[model samples]
Target: MKTFLFRSMIGIFFGAFLAVAITNCAVYFGGQELLDGETFLKNSLGSIFCGWFFTVSPLYFELKNLRLSQQTALHFMTVTILYFSLSFWIGWIPLHLKSILFFSGMFLTTYAIIWLSFYFYFKNIAKKLNQDLENI
Candidate 1:
């Protein structure tokens, strides 16, 4: 419980930082005021929630009965739902089928890349550890 609280605190701050950074970048690059005050607040809060959820969601994997694939799938589904719902609510994405689909594709692609990178990274670490054990 203490560890979870600590992680949640970290996640909230990280999420806030990310939200501000992303917003600033969008304002700078897009060359337009992207959000009014109310919307900006909503976006910021939504981002914090997302950060918290993402950080904590890995706890689901601690369930010994679920396979890795199952854990990943469940996490992915929850994240997708949370992200898109927030996106739409925060007015980041237009409430149109085409826009939703396009964003969904982009999000899925990015998620897959990150997930694969982590998977391979841990796999390499495991392999190296096993090799060292064999040498021992």
Candidate 2:
């Protein structure tokens, strides 16, 4: 319970940070402004939720520490495939049966974000787990 709470907290903050970073980059390079705060917030929320790998990896390792079952790995694979497929399809939906770039970029970016997110998430989890175990 405690570890999950900690993970959730970490995930929320990291998600927000990621959202803001991506949004800012988009605006800076794309030179497009949001029509309203609502739009910005919606987009940010989407960005944050998309980075669940941040919380998932640590939760997996945490489960390992607790000597939990291997279902975690199974869930990870399921969630991963689902995330990629959904993101890819939804991202290029507007392309409407045409446009390779749309699908390609969407697929690549989805995977890229997952990879980057997990890198930081797993790194932090490892550090904290060591600290936690040492104190135990």
lDDT of 2 by residue, 1-136 (tens): 8777777777777878987887788789888775467767766665566565557554554444444346445545755665555455445235455555666577567856875686689899999999999999
Model 1 Cα displacement at 124 (Å)? 0.5
Choose the strongest candidate by lDDT.
1
lDDT of 1 by residue, 95-125 (tens): 9999988998999899999889988999999
Candidate 1: regions farther than 4 A off: 26-35
Cα-lDDT of candidate 2: 0.64
C-alpha-based local distance difference test score of model 1: 0.88
Reference-based lDDT, residue 20, model 1? 94
